[model samples]
Target chain A: MTPQLEIVIIAVIVSAACSVLGVFLILRKMAMMTDAISHTILLGIVVAFFITESLTSPLLIIGAALVGLLTVYLTEALRRTRLMAEDSSIGIVFPFLFSIAIILITKYAGNIHLDVDSVLLGELVFVPFDRLIVLGRDIGAKSLYVMGTILFIDLLYVILFYKELKLVTFDAALAAVLGFSPIAIHYSLMGLVSITAVGAFEAVGSILVIAFMIGPPVSAYMITDKLRNMLILSTLIGIINSIIGYRLSVIFDVAIAGSIATVIGITFLIVFITAPKRGMLTIINSRRRRKIEYAMASLLLHLCNHENTDREEIESNRHSIYQHLNWSKKFLEKILYKALNLNYITLNNEYLKLTPKGREYAIRCYDDIGYSI
Target chain B: MQKHVIEVEDMTVAYEEKPVLWDIDINIPKGVLMAIVGPNGAGKSTLIKAMLNLVKPISGKVLFNGLSYECQRRYIGYVPQRGSVDWDFPTSVLDVVLMGTYGKIGWIKRPGKKEKEKSLDAIKKVGMEEFVDRQISQLSGGQQQRVFLARALVQDADIYFMDEPFQGVDAKTERAIINILKELRLRGKTVIVVHHDLQTVKEYFDWVALLNTKLIQYGKVDEVFTDENLRITYGSTDRVLKGEV
Candidate 1:
């Protein structure tokens, strides 16, 4: 395979692995845990280097994953103490471990190839240079094999335990009563998350790993109202984001990880504004429509209340009705025009009169506001 | 003498250091529609949670059909409060109801055709068949409560535990829920509800358990749901029983 194609393929695999677990993390409200695990796993790599005396030892991945689990375990333990909230506990534990890792690497392994910059801001552009060779024959990028295996594991874990994960994420109390051991499912998921973060850290860096983990899932969340669809859509969004990010980085000669992270943010922004039902624009439009409908109903009800009463002429006068309703003159004019167009009311010599349809609607609105209470 | 379906023996539960349920002992008979009524903060929900082993008790053991909770889990169902879950969780009514079968389907097994049919039937039983495909967030408060009821119904357990099922529901939905509870009793299922409305206690429940951090009285509704026991359970405030009795 071409070097450029290999680079994009590895990026896609990393995105897929991160995004699958991202769905559960977002649903479980543990997105911050991903941030914690990705950073703290650096301590694992530093400590493993100290033990094995080799930067490229396979044990580094295992060590990093173990420390990631340790991060989750410690954070949860602090949360269970009940003195502090989950977020506060995560804030305390994340930095404590991550800083220790940074200090160890700078103090003890400064001359080694394991620089903190490369770990934090992974350069995906150089991924093609690191080839995986088997039996003295060059095969492919090492990241491809690592990320492909992680993605396979993540998919199998989700598929085999789909119902269990859904139950635990949605209603942990129910999952507990049903003898499902929510804690077991919870930690297993965290374990997969840690492993995914560790595998992606070398290729995309810790910061981009978080973007790949949280961005696609949140964007897919806005587009679908089903868990199965959200999972599938999140994977698709991740792949598309990777391709666009790679193309952008190549064109602009920018850092690939930074470009990918930027693309994820832009994609989420677009999804947030334009998604059909749950988007910000749709929500704002619906709210505006409801406000106008409510204003029209209030006007119709006011006319109904005053029609044929002693105050009919004074209260129903369009020229002075805005004052009675405590609305701006322009606002009342807009509402009045909408009401007239809807045929709910008609103006008679500058006095407002309600038609039969208007009177019925007024009564319904009055019942909804007053009688329902 | 009716056989006891569940027995909570000297059960005490505490959060941190403060005790919520204090050395409470109660036994529920088979096939009785019972209500556990108490004032706010009286550990009503905690008691059910402790019995289900969802909360760890400081001291006590609960027996389900003379077995521990783990053994009797398949024969037990639960309906947490309507506000307990996030409704906007991107799932449909049918999917939530299908979760009732997850325990029976066991680990690593997905819900299949039989589970779907059972969930649909339960949805229809609660008069929510029309909304089986609707997203959960679009449901009204009453509809959400019914969906929870349908989820519990699909469990088809011998005993059902519901926490404040009538809360925030309309009068019609309340009536619908009571009818379903009655039907469950007719089918010889033990239904225990943590109820809030005192006026419906005598009319709706066949058995009553008046609790205030401890068991005050438990018996047939006519015998245990008296004004005297209510006053004691509600802390001598006749105001709580002013319109209740």
Candidate 2:
């Protein structure tokens, strides 16, 4: 396979893995913690590299995951103190670890191939060339195997502890009484998230890793209310963004990761505007439609109360009735025309009369108003 | 003559160095509706947390059914305070209640048909059958409380620990939940509630445990719901109850 194809395939897999776990993290309000893990893992990577003198060592993943778990443990410990809140704990720890990683990188490995830029932004373009050769056969990219393993772990952790994680996220104390240790589940989840970050770091870099982790899931959450559906949708969104991003990069001759992030952002905007039922435009239109319907119903009710009214009297009184409705004249006309087309109301030049359907609709509105009051 | 389901000995809970609840010993009998009442910050909720082993006591042991907490965990159900959870969490009423069956189903096992039946039954028991598919945030405060109660109910535990189940609920929901607690007592399950309302304590609870940084009283309402105990639990002045100052 070509090096570019290898990079695209690895990016797709890593992006999907991060997005799947990202859905839960965003839902649980742990998105920032994932960000924290991604940064702190740099320090762990630097330390592992210093000891092992090899960037390709699996020990880096283990070291990074351990640091991630430690970050969670330390954050919890700090929260126990009345002095510091949760966000502050995260603020204090990640910066310290991250600064240490930068210092170590500049001092020790700056002259070598390992540098800050490679660690922070990652090099997806070069990933395809870093192939794992096994038994004299060129097995795909090494990052693919690493990300794939972490993805499998993430999927297994979520599936195996699905009930426990759901219960604890919803109600931890209740989970405790029901013989499930929510703390245990919480730590395990953070551990898995950390491991995912570590695995995806080499391929996607740190910043793009966070975007991949949170963006697709958040976009999916905006469209669905079900957890299972959210998971599937987020994975699809992630994969779509990855493929689209790679294609966009190829077409525009730009950065692959940047293109991917832009695609995810665009998808979020699209979902925000076009989501069924809860989309911004849908809600606004529904409200406007309701108001117009209300005004038309009120007019029909007024005409029904004053049967056989003169055309002049009804026309002059239209403004008075519209005043009570607080609607624009154009809006009132639109609804009136719609009512006439549906045979809900009959307009004889200026006089308005409610048809059977219009009368029934007005009666339903009256019932609703009565019930609300 | 009822058997003691929970026995806490020399329980001391502290945050950092300062003590929150100190030197507490209490034996609660089974099959009674007991209310843990005290002023704010008196550790009423902490006591339940300690019993469930959610919080580690500075120095003590809490025994359930003559066994350690781990051994007797399956027999206990818990309903935390309303504010303890994020209301906007993406879960339907039925989904939240099905959590009660997680312990029985164990790790790695999903809630199957049996669990669903139990959850639906619990939702019906809580008068929330119509809202089984509604997201928890869409429900009223009282309805959310009912969902949590239903979640605990599906646990089918011998003992239920509820932290402020009536807090922020309407009068109708409060009465409905109390009725359910009474029903649980009838079925031979011990129900413990961390209640705040002193006015309803006498009427709602069959047994009472009053705490004011210490165990002031614990027994049947007729025996322990005295003015002297109230003064200790609510703190000495008694001006609030007397309607003076």
Candidate 3:
């Protein structure tokens, strides 16, 4: 019932929720929009603060979510106008809104008890102290309730429009023709992202939020091809990063958010290098293995073909055979001696005989190579 | 004397005050496979868009089944150009076809068992049942086109408007798609396709609408596909007709 455990729990839950939505956004190439929404949300928070005059007001979340939706709408409208490219549109809009928020904060809100630094880099240590009470009973952290609601909304939106969103993200025109409005689905998705951004912004700073949003999903993408699998993997990765990062921070005396981000980055790096089939290391090793197998197979074929020749005949024709195999004599001799040792072939007075094992091995090798090619 | 499934009267579509398709008037009867053919910039796509109300025409009216688009939206199905979407999108073939039932299912209601059955039937119709679970991005160009067709088929509409469905498809897939269109016609549905291959025009389409920035010809393949009209529709000059020896 201590606050530290509660804070870690809330952080983990919020991080997992953001990562779920992040998988879809990253797949749709809207990661930057998440960045834009996180920044522009500051303006919405400021506006809401100006109206409600309370930093803890629900108006801040509502106002920020609405602004997030507005950001998507305006960015889409600007993109359609040919006035500017997509990145440029995002760049122009978020900075303008964020700068205005900063000015308002410095000019009028500085004297107030508002803190922008906490908003930028969230105070996870303080989150558990903001308690939620229902009927004079302490339920949990207030941020947990807010984040849980946002997560529920995200899950609901994704489940309800899962098919429509997939179609629109892949092929908007086809979606439109099939009577699914890509525009509507797009707005709905962006709205969810905005809501998540605003809901989680106070708990996890915007920069670290990006790590939770994109890092897990991207790492999952590196490991899996199916969308459903990607979502599950991303959630697992997010949870792992949150727990490991928190523990590492506790042990090393570092910032929790920074440590969490570092964990995600490191996990992503591991997935990048070691993912099965598609990982960089796997691909490189497979290529090298294939080359070695190719040389070995060709050597077996050459020796099999020249089995009837004498030792002197084989030695004299080695140059022509090497040119035919396109292999160096050293590599050829190394493989040839290994095959002899394995009893796959016998070099008796310069004549080679295929042992039963060698013949069987050669046949299996050919089949494997043929099927793979 | 069957009623016209689609009727366009003096339709002109423009973007930013510049006209793209000018003064198009056409009437297509039910149960005919019609091809809308034109040169690259002749607004063939624009014409189809205008009919579907996807693109607003400068001045004209489009009627489907004797009703406005709003009233008969569910009765009409459209398949846009192949390149108009991101092929790398995260959806299976069956998932795309299930979207066809969304019109009747309405907003906020998820596609249920009936919709899934209808989608499977459509996928079977397009000979893509085996690939129903395959992600759209993993499909070949021709299979992708078939998936689009299956989506339209799942709509189960009386009239279908397809824009360049065979653009990047291989010959075998093109033939498979044509066979499905033929089956649709036999089932008494009117299917209109935006086609390009002039050589296979007669083989693929039962009705043809020749367009060159305007409606040059519209009738059955035997009735309106003349040497004179072909020259006017596709030849260098509208006035120059090739002589039939």
Candidate 4:
């Protein structure tokens, strides 16, 4: 396979793995914790390298996964102290552990292949160069097999624990009562997250790893109301982001990981603004419709109140109604047009009169407000 | 003599040295709908949480049918406060209701046809059959409360604990929930609720436990739900006086 193809394939696998787990992290409101875990796992890699004395040892991955779990444990422990909020706890624990790893790397591991900038912002361009050879027969890019294995494990974990994960995320108390052991599930998830970060770190870097982990899931969250659909949608979005990002990098000669992360951001922005039901456009449209409906309801009530009263001629006159309502003439005219369109009011000799339908609606609105009070 | 389904023995809970429930001991018998009533922050919800082991008790233990919570978990159902969960979660009413069956379904193994049937029946019982496929975010406060009640109903347990199921529900939804609770009692299940409405305690519950950091009085509604016990439970706050009278 071509180097460019291998690179795109690795980026796709990394994103697929990150986005699958990202669904749960997003649902559990622990997306920020991923940011913390992705950074702090560097400490685990450093310590593992010192012990193995070889950067290529598998212990580095295990070590990084452990440190990811440790970061979560420390953050939760700090939050449980009640002295600081959860975000503040994360803010403290993350930097404290991550900075330690940075210091160790710059001071001691300077002679190794590890560098701070490459760790934070990975070089996807080098992914195809790392080849896995078995008995002198070339297999494929090493990162491809690494990320492919990680994605397969992630898919298996999600499928096996989908029920438990869903129950716990939706309701932890109930999950506890039902004997699911939410704590165990939580640590296992963080463990996988750490492992995924470690696997994707060399290709996507830690900072961009967060974008892959959080971006697709949040975008999927805006599009679907079902967990399974969210998972599928996020995985699809991740693959699309990877391909588009790879193509864009080819055209612009920019960083591959950076390009992919930017595509993830752009995709989320598009989903946020255009998702069918929960998008910003839908919310704004609904708000405007509700405002018009409310105004029409108020107009119906006003006409109903004055239709047969002593001041009926003065108060119900269409021209002077806007003054009593403290509304602009243009706004009142829009409301009147809507009311007329809905047949809620009728203009009789320049005076606004409530139709029977309008009167019934006015009474119901009163009951709604009155009953609640 | 009655068969005690739940036995709370010297259960004391505290949060960071501030006692929420202190030395609470109550034996709840089967087939009785009981109410745990108190003023705001009176540990009514804490008492339920402690019993369900949701909140760790600083000291003491609770037993269900002579077994510990962990051993007897399958026989117990819990409905947390309606506001406890995020409503915007991307799941349908049927999906949330099916979660009740997770305990029986056990690790992995998605909810099959049987579980779906049970969930549908529970949703119908709560008058939410039409909303079975509707996303949870579109539900109103009362619909959300009913959906929670339906979720608990599908548990099909011997005993159920609900924390403020009627916190913000409409009167019609309240009636629907109380009917389900009454039906559960008629079927010989023990129903314990953390309730705030003082006026309905006499009407809705057969047994009442008045609590304020400690169990003040607990017995049949006519005997324990008295002005003196309420006054003791609520202290000098006129909230009790205004609500009960």
Question: DockQ for each of the predicted structures, in order?
Answer: 0.66, 0.46, 0.27, 0.71
Which model scores highest in TM-score?
4
Model 1: residues >4 Å from true position, as ranges?
A: A368-373, B238-245
Q: Rank all candidate structures by their TM-score, best first, as comma-separated numbers.
A: 4, 1, 2, 3
For residues B129-203, write the lDDT of model 4, one tens digit per residue: 999999999988999998999899889999999999989888898999999899999998989999988889988
- Cα lDDT for residue B203, candidate 2: 89
Tell me the deviation in Å of residue B92 in model 1.
0.6
Q: Provide the lDDT at B231 for model 3.
A: 74
Residue-wise C-alpha lDDT for candidate 4, range A184-245, written one tens digit per residue: 99999999999999999988898779998999999999999999999999999999999999
lDDT of each candidate versus the true structure:
0.92, 0.84, 0.81, 0.92
Mark the regions of model 4 whose C-alpha exceeds 4 Å error after superposition. Answer: A367-373, B237-239, B242-245
Q: What is the C-alpha RMSD of each candidate to the true structure, in Å?
A: 1.9, 4.7, 6.1, 1.6
- Residue pairs in candidate 4 whose N, alpha carbon or C atoms collide under 3 angstroms: A225-B90
Q: Give the clashing residue pairs of candidate 2, or none.
A: none
lDDT string for model 3 (B140-228, tens) is 88888998898888888999999999897877788899998999999999988888877788998989998878789989998987777
Task: Single out the weakest 10-residue window by summed lDDT for candidate 4 chain A.
Answer: A364-373
1 versus 2: better DockQ goes to: 1
Candidate 2 on A1-373: residue-level lDDT in tens?
A: 7888788888888888899889778877888898899989888888998889998888988888888998888887887776898899999988988898889989888877767776667778988778889999988888888888888888888777777777777777777777677778888888787888888877778877898999999888878777888888999999989999999989999877778888988998898898885688998999998877777767777666666555436443544545555667887778777888889887654656678898888878877774331
